[model samples]
Target: MSDIARELNLNPSEELDLLTKWLGRESTEHVRRIRSVHVANPALGLQLVWERLEESYGSPEVIERALFVRLENFPKFSNKDPQKLRELGDLLTELNSAKSEGYLPGLSYLDTTRGVNPIVEKLPYSLQEKWLAKGSQYKEQHYVSFPPFAYFTDFICGEARRRNDPSFSLTPTPSKTSIQYPKYEQPERAMRNVKRHISTHKTDVDVNRWTSQSDCSSFKPDDIGKQCPIHQKPHPLKKCRGFRSKPLEERKAFLKENGICFKCCSSTTHLAKNCKVALKCSECDSEDHVAALHPGPPPWGTENKNSPSQYGGEGEGPGSAVTSRCTEVCSRGQSFRSCSKICLVKVYPKAHPDRATNVYILLDDQSNRSLARSEFFDLFQIKGSHSPYTLRTCAGVTETSGRRATGFIAESLDGKMNVMLPTLIECNHMPDNRSEIPTPEVAQHHGHLKSIAHMIPCLDPDAQILVLLGRDVLQVHKVREQRNGPHSAPYAQRLDLGWVVVGNVCLGSAHKPTTVATYRTSVLENGRPSLLTPCPNQLQVKERFSSKIQNATSLRSVRHDSSVFDDCNLGNTIFQSTKDDDQISSSTAPKQSGTSTQ
Candidate 1:
């Protein structure tokens, strides 16, 4: 005998008490497993529901085991079959030798949905007509379908009452019985609505096409030319035959409830599923796909003039695809445009793998390489040589006289292979205005760049970004303009519908955010930025350090001529100082603001 049966036979009352207690614990464990199963198989469609009273075909074994456990308490549930509303089912299951695949009487009593094959489905056309037209007077026994037992309806109504959904109607067709059952309308559609299932696929045009198939299945496209049976005129299904088929009262209620025509779902246009204005692709004016996924040659031509291939294929190289990897801050795939607000980047110290620190990097396709501030090295490590290197910034050449560092190589972790792949370079470190972290209050939420900008914006903060990468590290992307109208301006329009990312190499088309401000780098003859005076007021400092400020011409204005200064003459030694000797310096430093121009 089973353990449960043996226990019940020995001490019926005490053993049953113990069994019930353990059932509660076991049910909790079962629910956790079922919940995970439900999430994993979400496409199961109302199968593994939590509420046992509702549709729960997926969890039949669990329910049966629990219900039978309740039956084990003889005195507690000795009345009839012990399971409520399932005496007939339990007895019938005994005949099948198991619960599964057993015929349960009134099992579908509470369900309102009609399956594909109803009782009248195979009946001749004349018998179907007679049954609907004659009702009780019809003498055919095979055609006369009756409701289940009256108590079955009461149980179903009680279940509905417990849920408190008053409008929850369960219209059950009767089995063959002599009871005077009320007429129930045939279920018009399945429980799932077509409109509710939309957006399961991508694009609006796909949604419209989906609704057309499910909602307009009764009428065929070829029927458009056929004359309506009621009006004897060539008209849409919703206008004549379909409308006349319903009773006068139902017709009035339908018009009152649905103010629009059934064919088009429109008040003005009463056409079929085919709308008057079809969906057109914004790129090629074709109805095949959305502009983002348009497969044909671009509107202008196959050759895009703004193609980066012409500009020497800026950021892309031959092997970028195999080496590209993204930081953890990216919530999406690496191929799309997202906010640069939170990004993590690793910077090595002049080819030294041991001194690499993962820091924040704001993607700037406009700048040349990743960057680091002098303050960052204080917290992290910095391997710099006595040799000085130059840096070109958005403002201009900001590092004409800093020690040139090289040991670090920028790298990304290849998650699939468990290897670190090198990026452009160990970002060149520069002195900023302050060492203190920027206040979060001053940082406003910047919307995504609407146009393609020369920047990548993932910063690992948890700290602020020290690096701004230009097209050199990013995959190459190109754009072509398409006019909105026949007479629209050619240059005025720009779409974010081209150049998708593959690994790190940009290959195809995907939607990207717009660029508000792009970092444009060019080779030009300009002067270096100028320095600020020590005095708080410009006039006071200008008088005191007039000669000093003139000598510090590299601080304010920037120039392109390579006047390479040695390590002694360069850097912020002559500027104001702050906590931990901030290279950007503090607010007290002249020509130094809260923002980092680098």
Candidate 2:
């Protein structure tokens, strides 16, 4: 559904002017697309014009009733246009202020009225009126048009009725004599068709392997005599005749029940194969699709739209993803290699991600906590006090541990979670590239986590750190908001550099750079953009030539400024510069007494 434009008291022409300059050419184009009679006729506000466009199909009576509303809401004004006042009086009279035989008092409408159409005899009277209104709209929008009376009659009486009652099909019920043929799929064809289906199912994660064989035992020559982990047979159990002789279903059940490797079915053997046990539906026990992927919502409540649509699964622009809260886009910055360990961030808790951001998060592994400095926690949450419980590391170091590592719970780089503390303790370090804790992964009970056994190992042994996670406080992964970024001009345009302190003018000029590539659709953010000026090619060429001539003459010990262009040939002599504005009018200055410069 389209968003309803907000109500505005301004006139349409005024709105169009402001929006054209403020919103741009693209917005003006969209305004042109608006199909409201008030847009060009009465010249209502854009908001009211859009609202009027949403009016359902109806007869002239609908417009008459709406006119009364517009009249009722009007306040008494001094010296209003006489023409508008007369028109208002005329509208009230046409709406039957005198209460004519066919009209209701105060412009109330009857749902049973059908103005002039009889084809809608079976349709509800309201739908009949709407049908006529749609025909009227089509007539207004097109030069040549025909009334869709028969079409609307069928739509209201047949298609709509069938939709309201699925069993109400217009086709006659088939006789019992009819037979339906069963469709079958060959093994090769079915798998090929599955590949085609897979193309449309977009996903972020790629499957690393199609099958697993974790239960299979080692097949090394030194462990050849080891007992099979599955059937307890010897290692390299490919020679087992009994297991191979079993039926497919029996073998599947045996492998699954015995904890044998389902892919290769080796109790103590090698791996790499497929499982014949097709995935079964939990609801029906049928070998087709899984229960989770089953279509339709649970037969509970219609409000539970968490299930995917019966046809298209998720991954369609998040267009229908439980759209209640804002999920703002946060771009990743590029990795700074080694010169800089800092990753800039500006997060807003109460507003959108694109909203102005003054808060920041910079990476400094040399320090303790991840986001802000140690004093940041005390300044924001605590008044020079630490918590009672001291945090200890895997190596039993509590030197930097504050009893209370105060953290705040808010939407952050990782997700919405508690990352603030009363006091921050120094954490360990890791590589530039690290994995994101699954966003759904919640915080484990901190009471149960006391030592190294409860912590995840850093890939680098020397850089072990206590990485935290939780729903209340999100885990900090390597923020990629700067990934493949900080290099492009447009991407840098998004940043507000109020907090940035650059001593070097090379980093960012003391004066702002001139805007370029501006167009009609450009949005004004910080300031007005000046129209781009073309480079002065003639002036540049003349300056360079004058400099060359002067240098040549100077080398020959000549000291006359006017003689610098004496040796140069020219098609026409360029006019000399003048400081006075009035002297620059009309055309170039008249040729001087003896100037050879061009």
C-alpha TM-score for every candidate: 0.19, 0.16
Top candidate (TM-score):
1
Positional deviation of residue 369's Cα in model 1 after best superposition, in angstroms: 4.4
Give the alpha carbon lDDT tens digit for every residue of 350-436 in model 1: 435544455544444555554545545454544454434566645455444333333344444221111222233444443221112
TM-score quality measure for candidate 1 = 0.19
Prediction RMSDs, each to the true structure: 28.0, 29.4
* lDDT digits (tens) for residues 1-598 of candidate 2: 1222225555556665555455445545555555244455535556653454344323446656675466455443222233333343343344443335444443343112342232244344554565666556545544334533233333333334333444633555564322111111112322221222111222222111111232222233223234432233343333332333334455455444433444433321322243344456555665543333233322122122333222111212323323211111111122111112212332332323323122333333333433233443333443444434333333233444332344343233333232332224423322232222101111111112112112222122112113222222223433423212233211111111111111111212222323221232322333333234434462423443444454543333444345544654562224432235257445455578876433
Predicted model with the maximum lDDT:
1
Mark the regions of model 2 whose C-alpha exceeds 4 Å error after superposition. Answer: 1-279, 282-545, 548-560, 567-573, 577-598
Give me the overall lDDT of model 2: 0.33
Candidate 2 TM-score versus the reference? 0.16
Q: Give the range where candidate 1 is weakest over 10 consecutive residues by summed lDDT.
A: 203-212
